[model samples]
Target: MNKQELIDAVAASTGESKASTGEGEGEALDAILEAVTSAVTRGEAVQLIAFGSFSTGACSERTGRNPSTGETITIPAAKTVKFTAGNSFKDAVNAA
Candidate 1:
């Protein structure tokens, strides 16, 4: 579901007002975003249990021919982030 739906569900489940849930959710999300950003910037992994980890990898520079022009050009290496879903999360999705 979307962010608002998640906030509403949290507020309903905890018997809390939407304002409180929204504030709490926003803070929590900001923390997560900050942590992941910092880790990725340092070329580190950010892992969350029963969820997944975010990690970066490099793509080596290589030569690839253009599809249209057929001209070979060097492709620069870049960092990428990847996520591996946890077993528990996979199980929950499969069970559903």
Candidate 2:
């Protein structure tokens, strides 16, 4: 689901209006999202023990082939966000 759908679901489960659910900096969901984004952007890890973890990782420059013309290209190194689901999350998904 998208952000709005997630916000709706969280708000409903918490018995709060979507707007009120996200107070202070904005909405609760938006605030959480922003916090995670900022943390990842700064190369920090955000771990929600039983849920999962988000962290930044680096990719080394590599050679790759263009799909269309089969031309070789250089893939530049870049930072990336990685997520590893926690045991509970993995179990939940597997059970389904």
Candidate 3:
């Protein structure tokens, strides 16, 4: 589901009124997401029990070929985000 749908669901579950402009749960969700994003951007990990962990990883520079021209090119290394699901989350998905 999209962000609005998620906000509606959270508001419903918590008995909060959902404003047209997404005031209550939407703001809370946005704050939570912002916190997670800020932490990850700083090369720190964020772990939520029964959900997942977000961490940073690296890709080394490598040579690759262009698909169209078949010409060799150097691919620069970059930082990446990684997520590993918690066992409870895995179990829930498997059960579903």
Candidate topping TM-score: 2
| Clashing pairs counted in every model | 0, 2, 0
List of clashing residue pairs for candidate 3: none
TM-score preference between candidates 1 and 3, better one: 3
RMSD of each: 2.9, 1.9, 2.4
Tens digit per residue, CA lDDT, model 2, 4-42: 787788888989988866644567777788899999998
lDDT of 1 by residue, 1-96 (tens): 987888788778988787766665555545657879999889888888999888988889999999999999999998888889988989999999
Residue ranges of candidate 1 with Cα displaced over 4 Å:
1-26
lDDT for model 3 comes to 0.88
Number of clashing residue pairs, candidate 3: 0
Q: How many residue pairs of model 1 clash at the backbone?
A: 0
